[model samples]
Target: MAIEIYGIKNCDTMKKARAWLDAAGIEYRLHDYKVEGADPDRLKQWAGVVGWEKLLNRAGTTFRKLPEDDRAVADADGAIALMVAHPSLIKRPVVEYDGGVLVGFSGDKWDEMLR
Candidate 1:
């Protein structure tokens, strides 16, 4: 079951998710967007599965600090562009497993799907 976790390495949510995966004995790879940068193609793919709305992290400080026009995105394309430009705008710890993609961290949901 190829599982890849994506997020900023220093994010608290990323730390918690990594700890959970480690404790669960789950083998996975970390795709730290802060270091490697986000891919437009991959962002588009994730958006397709979960909807750009769910992938975009409007509540995060990065989004909050964006220009008003950037935050006023009206569609997936707009959101994707924003995310690609600012990877921090995407929700943290997006896990992509063999079955599907999971956006954000929720212990119950992670256990149900990842465990």
Candidate 2:
């Protein structure tokens, strides 16, 4: 199975997820958005599968720090633009695995999907 995890290297959640994968002995690749940046096409694709609402990290500091107008995005395009411009605006550790994509880190969910 092809599993790619995307997140910033220094993010706390990213660290937890990486540690979990390490303990589980799951082989995967880390797409550190902070260093590598995000692909607009890929962001759009994730938005399609999970809906832009789920992909957007409204809880994160990056999104919270955005201008009020930017935060009031009423459509996927608006959210996508923000996320593409600032990858941190997207949720942490988006895992693309087993023909599907998942955003955020949850041990149960990761095990369910990967195992």
Candidate 3:
């Protein structure tokens, strides 16, 4: 399967996900949002798959630092806009594998999908 992993390079979760892929010998492409920027269209697509609540990283500093007005707007469109402006506001280690997409990394989930 062809996998495309997206996240900031230095994130601990991203590091773990990359390491897991490497150990499993999974060939995947890395798309660093810090460098490439997160695409709104892609974010919308991911939201369709995982829902806006799952795609947005409200616990992250990027989201927490947003102004009250911006933070209050938490719908799909609002969240997508925030993510487009601050890619770090999105969850870490979003991986696209073939026709399926996985947001966030859990060792068990990775093992099941990769195995």
For all candidates in order, the CA lDDT equals: 0.93, 0.91, 0.91
lDDT of 3 by residue, 41-65 (tens): 9999999998988988989888888
CA displacement after TM-score superposition, residue 64 of candidate 2 (Å): 1.8
Tens-place lDDT per residue, model 1, 1-115, is 7899999999999999999999999999999997899999999999899999999999988998989988899999999888988999999989999889999999999999988
Cα misplacement distance, residue 55 of candidate 1 (Å):
0.4
Q: Count the backbone clashes (under 3 Å) in each candidate.
A: 0, 0, 0
Q: How do all models score by TM-score?
A: 0.97, 0.96, 0.96
Clashing pairs in 2: none
Residue 23 error, candidate 1, Å:
0.3
- What ranges in model 2 sit over 4 Å off? none
Model 2 vs truth, CA RMSD: 0.9
For candidate 2, the TM-score is 0.96
Deviation of model 3 at 112, angstroms: 1.1
